[model samples]
Target chain A: MPNLYQEVIFWALFAITVFSALLVVGQRDMFRSALALIVTFLAIAGIFAQMNAEFLAVAQVLIYVGAVSVLVIFAVMFTKDMPHSTRSTNLQPVSIVVVGLLFIALSWAIFQSQWNEMPAELPVFVESTLVDSSSQLGTAIIRDYVMAFETVGVLLLAAVVGALALVRDK
Target chain B: MLERYLLLSVILFCIGLYGALSRRNIIAVLICTELMLNGVNVALVAFSRYSTPAFMRLTSVDASDSVKVLDGQAFAIFVVVVAAAEVALGLALVIALIRSRNTTDVTEINLMGN
Candidate 1:
């Protein structure tokens, strides 16, 4: 029961995500690249919504777009001429070869793996009671992944403390 | 549908890898890593959506059927949180490097004298 409207929207978001990712990598201007990355984050968040991940969509927007990208930009400001960041670097040729080979190898392995099949009853999850938002997710977090969740929070706190300690005037 | 999402994920991942490897700017590399993390995240969430038995049996009235519903999504959230922590620390390191070395270029940050 997929409609043309949904397909169009999906493709549009897909294009935005891919295009902005390319921009994030290829653009020399750091601020421009950060903006492109924000676009990519927003597009991916839209894709999450398209896939019926309402909670994740919101989290993606809040964390990636709102928090991470802004942090990147602020960090960019700490360096002068960082916006215009000239010089592509000497590693690019080696990087191209490495990344291309990795892509080929990964694609081959994935294609070889027979786990590409979706469930027979394929959940489009439009009206399912399991809208599966933050409530269920919170339950799962505090239940199944409780340790990981708490560890991550602790890790974030440590990172904050370590950063302050590291950047202090000596 | 799953294939398409995974394909997109692979492409996104490779692009991030390229960026991380090719960019001399430490900030660019950090951003690229975020891109790569997002790529993994898409795959996880897509699996949670389309491949999980919970989603398949979503309409079942059994109470336990909802337990592992979006484990992938939960894992993705964890990844996102960790990535944020990583970026914070990484950027701090970059700032510290700039303060010490007076440059943002990765090639120039040589601590060990050769």
Candidate 2:
């Protein structure tokens, strides 16, 4: 049986995730949407915490909510008069019905999958060696997935340089 | 419990997809993308917990073991890092587009001829 605290946390995170996601889609103001997106990120981080991936929870907060959301908001601030053009074109009834049908089909497929039958048990956690997570992660990136890690770094560098070039005035 | 979480993930994903496909504003589309990413994160962590031994047999698995918990945690870390990179690139592109077009509407960016 799950603990009361865990259950509560799950529900809270679930509510936040779903509600903020809805806000992201439904809100007219782009800034509001961005703010809702931050809430959604936080809720997801909380889900990570529930999953016993504490490092991921912290990273989610630090990287996604802290960095990505801010970058998007900054871009929004620099580019547009967001308040003036808050309202987007409405979706047609036919499109909404189609999307609704698609959602149902997808949900049904997910429901039918046998997720629990092939349970690969999680490894044990050692409290004394909790500090090794970052190191282990670093080692994994350097040893096993070094190429992919380096490629991601290069991609980031390219993005930065490309942004500068794109934003530069002729 | 897994059903509820999965349902929430699906809802969030669809909302994001709708925003991405339907919205004309570029910033709105970006926000939608972030929402989609968050939805994916929720599902990943949820699956990790649902399958983890600690979570499955809560009374038996000690709370202190960290190595056992690294797989999902590591994947989440990588996802976060990639997301950061994606946002940086995406925002840069948006900035560039805004500078060139003087507008952020998808409908308005018709410079690429067919």
The C-alpha TM-scores of every prediction are: 0.89, 0.81
List residue ranges in candidate 1 displaced over 4 A. A82-85, A120-129, B53-62
lDDT of 2 by residue, A1-170 (tens): 66899899889888888888888888877778888888988888888767656677788888888888888888867865632455554553544666688789879987997766214332334332334555655554566566777787887788778767766788
- Candidate 2 error regions (>4 Å): A82-95, A117-139, B52-72
Model 2 residue pairs with clashes: A122-B53, A123-B68, A125-B64, A125-B65, A125-B66, A126-B64, A126-B65, A126-B66, A127-B64
**Weakest 10 consecutive residues, lDDT, candidate 2 chain A?**
A117-126
- DockQ, all models: 0.58, 0.40
Q: Which 10 consecutive positions of candidate 1 chain B have the poorest summed lDDT?
A: B52-61
- Chain B TM-scores across candidates: 0.87, 0.79
Candidate 1 lDDT by residue in tens digits, B25-108 = 889999999999999999898877666453344455455446565787898998989998898888889888877777888777
Let me know the TM-score candidate 2 reaches against the reference structure. 0.81
The number of the candidate with the highest DockQ is 1
